[model samples]
Target: MSPDLWSFALAVYARPDVEAACLRLQSAGANVCLMLCGLWLEQRDATCDDRRVHQLRQITDPWDRDVVQPLRALRLQWKEAADTDPLLKGMREQIKGMELEAERALLSRLEGMAQGWARNSKESSDWLEALAGEAANLNRDALRVLRVAAAGA
Candidate 1:
């Protein structure tokens, strides 16, 4: 629970069904990094509140929209051509790595944001819903798997 967000994210993401669930949620427009940060907070028993949520969005929105998304878009755009071109495939792989690094950086920022928050004794918080926002309904099954896996984390 005390693990840094990156480590926590890696551990939880490696669990069975987690990657597929995360991909589904991502395809539905959920920020997988934010959701992972939410899971970290949940595991740490941090209280979920509107102000913190707002702050998180503030920190995430610009970085995600400006940085991460572009890399993702580029990687996706190259996917079809990369399959036929070895050079393009290698470059696309690099973009994929960059995208992952961008996410890791975002998670570090999120962990820093929660540094002063105190953990509570409650068994759970409403973070998954709060973080998922509108995308929650679009992928309940994915969220369920993610939630269960994170709870174990």
Candidate 2:
């Protein structure tokens, strides 16, 4: 396994069914960066208690809200125009890259924060659920699918 969060995330995200499950969770208002962090923690066998969840959220939410969201918004805002305007299309691609890089930065920070945490034998599904909490639009089935994918089941 990779020693860093970004590489770990890339590996897990490429696993079967994970991409679709992540997209489903993302559409339901879950922060994908946080979700990826949760998986990273799981891979590290970290404990998934409420306090840890809260701590993780505190570390990630601000960067996700302030930086990543804005870039995503800008890229999305150009979606329609990008279809026709070649210049806008190029600019939108650049914004998309920046957004991904911002996410990578957040993952790096999250990994740093979690580096010294004690590891446990907790189930990855439990960690995933704890990190994800209860999103209004993420139904139980969707969560189950996510869990299955996270577990590589």
Q: lDDT per model, in order?
A: 0.89, 0.79
Candidate 1 — what's its lDDT?
Answer: 0.89
lDDT of 1 by residue, 18-48 (tens): 9999988888888899889988887778989
- Could you give candidate 2's per-residue lDDT for residues 51-150 as a string of tens digits? 8788889988899889999999999999998999999999999999999999999998888888888888543325677776676246556666655665
On a 0 to 100 scale, what is the lDDT of residue 121 in model 2?
Answer: 54
Worst 10 residues of 1 by lDDT: 118-127
Q: Name the candidate that leads on lDDT.
A: 1
C-alpha displacement of 83 in model 1, angstroms?
1.3
Of the candidates shown, which would achieve the greatest TM-score relative to the real structure?
1
Could you tally the backbone clashes for each prediction? 0, 0
Error of 2 at 100 (Å): 0.2
Against the true structure, what is each candidate's TM-score? 0.93, 0.87
- Candidate 2 local Cα displacement, residue 150, angstroms: 4.3
